[model samples]
Target: MRPGAIVIASSLLVCGAIIGCERDDMWEQPKTAVLGTNEFFDNDQGARMPVKGTVARGADNLQEDDLLYRGMENGKLAERFPFEITENDLNAGHDKYDAFCSPCHAKSGDGMGMIVQRGYKQPFSFHIDRLRNATPGYFYSVLIRGLRPTQLPGVKFEPDDDKVHPAVAHKLSPVERWQIIAYIRALQLSQNATIEDVPMEQRGELDKPKTEGSNGESH
Candidate 1:
């Protein structure tokens, strides 16, 4: 064959090999599809069962404290906090409450937060008989799982489980959720408190004439 013709034939062979390499057959090579039937395993499930006693990521220490992680004791809602609460914890709770809860539940826990004023559904007042008597675990459950639309049929907020507040689910940690609950209790007490509820030292502050201005100057 002519030299020029031989060169053209060699280039065509190279091009054909390159084109074959780029075909989808490389990616479609033998492999089981997820959930696809596989006779190799006894159960015939392509997806093998996870190894026994395997713990999921970020869940290794979950079993350490049931009350702390799940807000439950003996399979029932916890009646009290899992850890001791200090003044600093309450302060932290106040900050978290104002940042997250105050939008819907209001800083005073009156269910009249700014969002409600702007047309969002008003939440139940924390001072109400039902909520005032609710256990701390109940609040913790709400923070973690949120109110499903069908969870509380006749409840005030009619919380949609799917529409869980992002801040509560993703931002606030478990300890932070407890702190917010403590702050909530404080708000409830403040709203329902009476003269007798005040300490003798603090009672004098309440009796002082209500200040008229931000500067605390008498009008």
Candidate 2:
């Protein structure tokens, strides 16, 4: 036999062996031995795997322990926080209320904000019987979870994007939330006050402060 013919025969034998050993199961459908949701093959063997964690839509995992309004330590509501009402808290609450609540409830606690001026449905007055009689727990629940929507215009939309929309987590801490509540209480008292409640001399201080320009001239 010629050397080239022997080489060709050897090559054919090697090719035949390679072809015969090749697995044709790559395109085959996976066989289900156990017909259950959790059963699946990994590395050609059945295995159960845990799913990964993901952020819920519109919700943020705020560190509650670090929050100012940390709910009860032993899973009970702390009706009275350790902090007392200071001038600083009142000031901070005033500023925060203006930024957040004032858009819906005006400075006077009347539901006549700019949105209402533009034809948005006015929210209920804070002095209303239901809200006025609400406990701190009720206020906190409403502020945190928000009210349910009953009709065409909803009170507040459900948070779906933690990034864009401001959740209760983003706005106020536990302490700050309480501070705002205190400030609201103060507002309510002031509004409900009679002539007997106001001292004659100190009443003048309640008037709006005069604004002065850089040159000390009133605009």
Candidate 3:
């Protein structure tokens, strides 16, 4: 065969090979076809299998509920949790509160934290009778789920891997969160308590002791 004819044949062979190598459906226009058993089988066969024991997407069984706000497992509400509020728990809660909540709720729980100082809206004071009357469960719910901005603007916090956010807006571990509730209760009582509510002997502890300096003026 002539060299030129040989070259033309080689080019045609290469072109055919290239066309064959292209994906089967690449050049074909998409067709609207009714679902068929074989097509369904093919689609499912190619689909990624879900990890073992993976719950279905959007399943309510996997949802964290208000029960978890108290750190109790769902369906086990009657059972007492292992952790309880101790003085140490309260202290740790105070630290966490100062780090996360003090920005908005303020150190005094008066809804006048530093954010409000910069012209942000203030939160309700924990000392309010309405708030003081609320259950610890209520506080836990608010802290864990966060108030929707549409419902109560700028109050939401996102949860983390343990399903607890480091901030008040995320879900906290049951015990640590309850400790925060205990501390808030203490703050409310301190600000809004009657003398009769206090024990008579311990009432003296509420007053500050007089301090005299070298200048003889009370400090």
lDDT of each: 0.79, 0.61, 0.62
For 1-219, candidate 1 gives per-residue lDDT tens digits of: 999999999999999998877756877656788888777889888898768998666661456687987788898888999899899889899999888888888877888888989988767788988788889998887887776545645445533523333325566788998998998988889899888998888877876886656452111
In model 3, the worst 10-residue window by lDDT is 157-166
Model 1, runs deviating above 4 Å: 1-56, 152-167, 209-219
TM-score for candidate 3: 0.51
Candidate with better TM-score, 1 vs 3: 1
What stretches of model 2 exceed 4 Å from their correct place? Answer: 1-82, 149-167, 200-219
Could you tell me the lDDT of residue 156 within candidate 3?
A: 38
Best by TM-score: 1
Q: How much is the lDDT of residue 29 in candidate 3?
A: 38
Candidate 2, residue 103: the lDDT equals 76
RMSD of each: 10.9, 15.4, 15.4
Give lDDT tens digits, candidate 3, residues 1-219: 999999999999999998888765765435433442233444634344576989778443365653544434453322333356688877877877777677878877998888879977666778877677766655765676554434433233233312221235433455667767778877788788799998999889879564455342111
The stretch of ten residues in a row with the least summed lDDT in candidate 1 is 158-167
* Cα lDDT for residue 58, candidate 2: 33
Local accuracy of candidate 2 as per-residue lDDT tens digits, 42-77: 444444343467554434244555223443445444
